[model samples]
Target: MAQTDTPGEHASVLRLPGIVLGVGLGGFADGILLHQLLQWHHMLTSTDQDRIGVKYYDPDTVPGLRMNTVWDGIFHTVCWLAVLTGLAILYARVTQDRRRVWTSRVLWGWMLVGWGLFNLVEGVLDHHVLGIHHVYAGDGQLWWDLAFLLMGALLVGGALLLQRGGRPLALPAGAPGPDAR
Candidate 1:
């Protein structure tokens, strides 16, 4: 990453905010769609004592759903904090070329990268390692979980390609920034 003696020009500094923002937003999308609207799974919906030795919480039951909902709310709260942190970082770093950076494909690409990372990490931890919940519970749930990871990988790949096309910001590290567009 090039440094123009300017903090905003630093490659990682510029990209970090966008990715963090994307992670939070992506998590919100997942929680809302899969957990709330679709009623697919909750924080501990997949727990089975035999498998993981954790008490199962049946999402169909009121008490069980209540517990799951509480955990889900906590997850969302963390995501909200992440979004705030990301925006705060962006507001601090991008002191110039506000319009350009805001519209640049690089920023968008970084955001996608963040979202993909969130999906990949969360899918692995929650759906696979922890087995707390699946993308969709019940039969063939593994397929759903795998599909989620695949989408994340695709998003990251596509985002990298998109970033390559975003000139100026996309310029190789150590290169000078192009004049304001």
Candidate 2:
């Protein structure tokens, strides 16, 4: 006996679930480490607390002013929304391209690239030199900040690697050789 392909198996493997898993993992790291472990008060804001009608104090002077996990929740919420939206798009695309060999891999690669870009831009503008935020606002925050950027780069690079490796595995049952396409 021979195994037969199902109607929706490809879409099931490639769509909403995949996006949710990838984005959830990445978002959890940001919420837990960057927003919670590090005392970065303003994780989602672009301005100083004083300028935004919130109190401000030098870490030395302020006694209890430490990391705020509230913003972590907010960041996580946003990440969830992004992942949901990406999942919707992935579902649609995969449905339309169910028979296409590279559709799923390409979709996954694109999502990874988008997530990395988000991290790089947000990390630099909000957490780095602007001082709007930090991965850890406490003492010696530079290394944490660098690590965040490095993680983003790694995500993007890993996606590219997957895209390359996926090509040979994407052929349909009776498809001709690569050169034919």
Candidate 3:
């Protein structure tokens, strides 16, 4: 990345806040689209025990639906916290740096990278390592999980392409500060 003489310009180009926001937003997308909209799977729909084998929750049942709803709420809470934290970091970065560019290619690229990271991490940890839940909480779970990772990889690759050749947009003169925005 090119750097200006001023330290704030360089700092503004870091794009860490954008990345964080992307990750958190990506998580929200997953939770909202996949979990709620499509009704694919819940947080704890597919459960496996050491000796008791595997069990699947019936969404039709009141108790089962309640359990799934609770878990889903927990998942939503985590995603919400991530977004709020990311917004806080972004506010700090933008306000602290005078020359911070709000609409930079690097920032958008990094945000895409963050979303990719969210997908990769969540897919690996939740779907494989922890085996708590998956994209499709039933047989052939591995294929669906692998597909999620592949999509994440695509997002990262796309971000790299976007970041390759673009100049950062300067913040508008006389623009209201982050407090107003």
Candidate 4:
């Protein structure tokens, strides 16, 4: 039988929609709060330190800041696309009882899982692997970066625990939704 033939067997996979949503939302939070409001860091802010020799775009200079702003816009666009895609997937997967699904621990857990994954991947790849930027990129920057990773770990672990108590969602287990594939 194909994967869609057994919803029960793939019940956990339903988290995909929530995860995608979380990735976008979490990214928005990061960009809005950190990049805009806090002025903490911008895209390519630390490219001067990049391991791969990316041209640095210093946020302190007009030309540099312009470049960083453009890159930030690109980042936000990607996040926006992720959110749109996530919503489309969610609409297809949950054909009924969306209110309950929205309130369910499972959905929230999956969302947290997505957020955590974002932090983990971004923190590691951007902060550590890519040498792009630190969380604060100043005194005690490593501490902030480490803290970010720690928060991600905690979120993922806590979300998994929370999801354990959730009842299985009332999706059409036998009947595939539009996203059955």
Candidate 5:
């Protein structure tokens, strides 16, 4: 038998929000903990700073690197952009598809997948092999890197679980019925 797909099946209302939330949080962690709190080196390099050794110096004693806060601003800007875009998409979906409200599971699942991928790639390339940076290079940085990897694994695993569980809530009104077109 040929199966007919419904709007719910084709439309993903939570996908954009999930991406936004994940990216926003990741940027937040990088800006707050890595940049502000622990004071690690920024990833974005400019021309002037590139000429000097600011990119590869200890955060504590590097004067040229200390004043360079452009990366921090850029990080926050990107985070806000992601979040705003997500919000816009979510709002549009909610208004347009008044019949069926999106499920939290879908949103969370999206976030998990996005975050997991980010963590996995960043951890492997930056933390493991390149050794260009670590979460906390001052004391027990290796352990921190390991923990970061573990966190990434957990996020991916949790997302898999959510995907397996599927949607637990009943479909909203006006949405296609379980047995209807």
Candidate 6:
């Protein structure tokens, strides 16, 4: 007889979807709040305003605004892809193992981790290292950058605590965890 269910086939599968979703949402939040709403920065806004290839565009000019808008569209596309990919992975995992609970502690914990990871990577690479953009590109930019990193650290730390405090979310043997049918 063929095996029907594989609950433990892929350990750590439950957290994958949440993490991806968080990462995508985090990206969306950054793009919306910082780039769109506050108008603090754009995708290619940087200190080196005259860089070749990816030249910086002023937010005031129509051509410059168009350039930044294009780059922003690209960024949003990537975030959208992340969400779709996460959903695909989640569907596959859920079908494979019906016991995976959507609201488990592990899922929430990893989601926070993923969001934090996004902020850390984006903040460090774009703001500090590459100078591509900062949370607020102006005098005392370092303060904003540090604050962003601090927020990321807090998210990661909080996630670890949540994961540690909760009991492992697993249905007991012979128990039906979810009803797909």
**Predicted model with the maximum lDDT:** 1
Say which candidate scores most in TM-score: 4
- Residue-by-residue lDDT tens digits, candidate 3, 78-146: 878877877787666565443444545566676788899999999988787767678986688789999
TM-score of 5: 0.65
Residue range with the least summed lDDT across 10 consecutive positions in model 3 = 172-181
Model 3 regions lying over 4 Å from their true place = 1-14, 49-58, 96-102, 169-181
Error of 4 at 130 (Å): 0.9
lDDT of 3: 0.70
TM-score of each: 0.84, 0.57, 0.76, 0.87, 0.65, 0.80
Model 1 CA deviation exceeding 4 Å by range: 1-10, 49-52, 169-181
Regions more than 4 Å wrong, model 5: 1-11, 38-54, 65-68, 96-103, 138-140, 166-181
State the lDDT at 87 in candidate 1: 88
- Please rank every candidate by TM-score, starting with the best: 4, 1, 6, 3, 5, 2
Pairs in steric clash, model 4 = none
lDDT (Cα, 0-100) at 74 in candidate 6: 96
Ranked by TM-score, the better of candidates 3 and 5 is 3
Q: Can you write out model 5's per-residue Cα lDDT over 1-181, one digit (the tens) per residue?
A: 1134443453355556666667676666767877778665554322223333335543344564654465567667877887687667666655433333344555666667667766777777666666555666547867887888888889878975664444423445554322111
Error of 5 at 145 (Å): 1.5
- Residue 73 in candidate 6, Cα distance off native in Å: 1.0
User: What Cα-based lDDT does every candidate model obtain?
Assistant: 0.79, 0.54, 0.70, 0.78, 0.58, 0.72
Task: Count clashing residue pairs in model 6.
Answer: 0
Stretches of candidate 4 exceeding 4 Å from the true structure: 1-13, 169-181
